[model samples]
Target: MHRTAPRLARILACAAVPVMLVASGCSSDSDGKPKAEKSQKSEKTDKAGSSGGAALATPESEKKPAVAPVKFTKLPEACRSLKPKTIEKLVPSTKAKAGTPGRSTDLLTRGSCSWNGLDDNGVKGSQYRWLDVSFLRFESDAALGTSGKQRAQEAYTKEVAKNRATTGAKNVKAAPSAGVGEEATALSYQLRKTGEDFSYVTIVTRTDNILITLTYNGTGYAGAKPPAVADLLKDAVPAVKETVTSVTAANK
Candidate 1:
């Protein structure tokens, strides 16, 4: 009985060795670090940042974004934007004083009109004239894509350059126009059309997202003198200013 008791005590002590090693947190790593401590450090690093030492990437919803607003909601009528006297002066002896409208799928985005006339005086002489007006509008919508004013500004530059590059143009001149709109450009030149040397003046202006292009040209045939460029410019300024005003009026 005494030998059996002693043997049982030895066996219990040997079994407790493994429990002691586990409680002490023994591991194969040579750094002397407990397995639990190593696991804790690894977990913290996985979190990327937790102690304010480093920050996570910013979320899109929290970042600052670019934005631009567009003014004016619609465009004016292409044919009625100009006054009766203005039309008469631009296109003398007109077939239709109301002007001819262009095809447009969306008036809020674009509109245009044109007029041409020949004033006949038989043996005295014959005078010819032509006029055109176009308006383009844009909207600042994220869904529709891009900024409205930016698009119009690009179009404004393109249109002005195109007019100044007219084929077979003579004495072409360019200058900034004032008191017309937010910004405007005037291009004057001479072109032989309708069997006469016609004076051409194109006024390109913009107000917000809307671009206004006004062209006035006149020529003389059968010994008649073409109209002065200065006179045409003077008349064009008022007519263009009125068109810009009409855009503002349409929105109001």
Candidate 2:
């Protein structure tokens, strides 16, 4: 009875070992698999959340404001800006009735035209006249952050300063004039060249984003009297008015 009882107890112990092992295996499969799946899901969610947050952190400057538009985009033809009649009266006996167009790679931004003539009058003398007009247009720049009219004003100031500092110019006088454009300045001076005294008058005016600089100069030959400042300005002021008027017409 003692040996049988000991064998039976060994068998029961072996059977209980298998039962515990089965229970442990089932627990590992259920709990370990769920934990692994949950951990993987958590890692994936963390990665997705981090990626979404990175997308929303853009700088404010990346959405810059739009630049203001310019008023004038097209420049008129340099030679045709003035009327033929106006040209004849300003520069009498001009060889080039159509005026000479200044060289320019881009006509949309800057352009110029000039007319010169010598009206001969027998032994009394010859009247020499030269007239030229230049147009400069400014456009709003987004990178530079400057408006077109502001740029034009800067250019106008520079032009006036430059004319004031002409080399060998005498009796330089600058005066603000009305009825020409938004603002007009007449710069007058005397310059002697080629053994003759020349009277020069320059009218610099700015209209919106455009600048019109008109210069009229004359000298007498064969002992004739040089033109007076009044004479130079009489034509210069009107010519500038006409040129300024043309700017409005060109836009229309």
Judged by lDDT, which candidate is best?
2
Pairs that collide in candidate 1 are: none
| Model 2 worst lDDT window (10 residues) | 27-36
Q: Write the per-residue lDDT of candidate 2 for residues 16-89, one digit (tens) a residue.
A: 99899887676555556655667888899999999998898776676565567888888888788888898999
- Identify the runs in model 1 with alpha carbons over 4 angstroms from their true place: 1-27, 31-37, 40-55, 61-64, 141-147
Q: How does candidate 1 fare on TM-score?
A: 0.78
RMSD of 2: 5.8
Alpha-carbon TM-score of each model against the true structure? 0.78, 0.77
lDDT of all predictions: 0.87, 0.90
